[model samples]
Target: MQDYLKPTEIIDWQHPQVLSLARDLAGDRADSTAIAKICFEWVRDEIRHSCDYRLNPVTCRASDVLEFRTGYCFAKSHLLAALLRANGIPAGFCYQRLSINDDGAPYSLHGFNAVYLPEWGWYRVDARGNKLGVNAKFVPPEECLAYQPRLPGECDFPEIFPEPLAVVIEALQAHQTWDGLLKNLPDRVSVLNS
Candidate 1:
């Protein structure tokens, strides 16, 4: 969809660095699926997750995420979307509400991307950077996201947003450090009720 391909303040796929990286990643690959996989893996492996690495200067926009090479899960999604859109592939944002500690009580939004593939339609992928227990891959028609909703409060959101949620952007902009963002991670119920 044109809506998913268009650049925005958060997606910012038209930025020089993003454009260049997309071009570099796509590199002589004519297949959209292949190009999409390359871009997804790059973001998933190359970019550092803020909380996992305890990195600072929280980033929101796609350019800033790529520039700093670090971002929260939501911010990382922005970069992945930008990269896919840069290559003329349609991409959009998706979210999941999960227990912060895999226990109950605290639940927050986890963000990832859904890319439109010609044969498989829109497929969801998580570029949140893999760790010891987490592994996300780009296998079409079969999603392998980093985290699944297992707790009672946790749920997988069905909508694919053309733009990053306002709450996500606001939280990223408001927090200046990894701990700050972690303490105040955005929740989905608030967004739904409002």
Candidate 2:
């Protein structure tokens, strides 16, 4: 629990700006659930998805995402994790391998978060901005992830990690530009076989 809340090199919840924004978002919200909801909504709605908006020069750090108010799914997850942790909720990373097309081929890693609510244990939520058909809400004990596995190879990686996976960070950092990052994004992540 402490590990999830602690600021890391990437999460950086302790950064002054992050802390300030977290406080602002959770304002007048007493319950942990409400705080989590507020933070989740703020991230999901306020932060524009980089690829969706076609913003360039990929950003991986949580603070950078907040400062820019734009990021890819992975970067957005980092920001959500940081915000939740900054507000005293335990938050960790989760992923899914989803097919880019309907055929269930060309799968790639998609990022989201699992937050531990005092009453509900760990709950997964996708703060990826909502569009016409996508709506991710913070409902404990009921999962509403951003994407559902529809094809044969598509699946969720259920592990709740204290920090972003190194492979994800490497992939984001490897590509300097958004188009390049999106183009070369890992089609597969080397998760341990269950």
Where does model 1 exceed 4 Å of error? none
What is the overall TM-score of model 1 with all chains considered together?
A: 0.97
lDDT of each: 0.93, 0.87
Q: Write the per-residue lDDT of candidate 2 for residues 1-194, one digit (tens) a residue.
A: 78898999899899899999999989888799889988999999999998889886688899999888888899999999999999999999998888766586677889999999988999999998998778888777888878998788888887999998887899988887778887776655565353
Residue-wise C-alpha lDDT for candidate 1, range 50-166, written one tens digit per residue: 999999889999999999999999999999999999999999999999999889979898999999999999999999999998989998889899988888988998889899889
Task: State the lDDT at 47 in candidate 1.
Answer: 94
Best by TM-score: 1
TM-score of each: 0.97, 0.95
The parts of candidate 2 lying over 4 Å away from their true place are none
Global lDDT of model 2 = 0.87
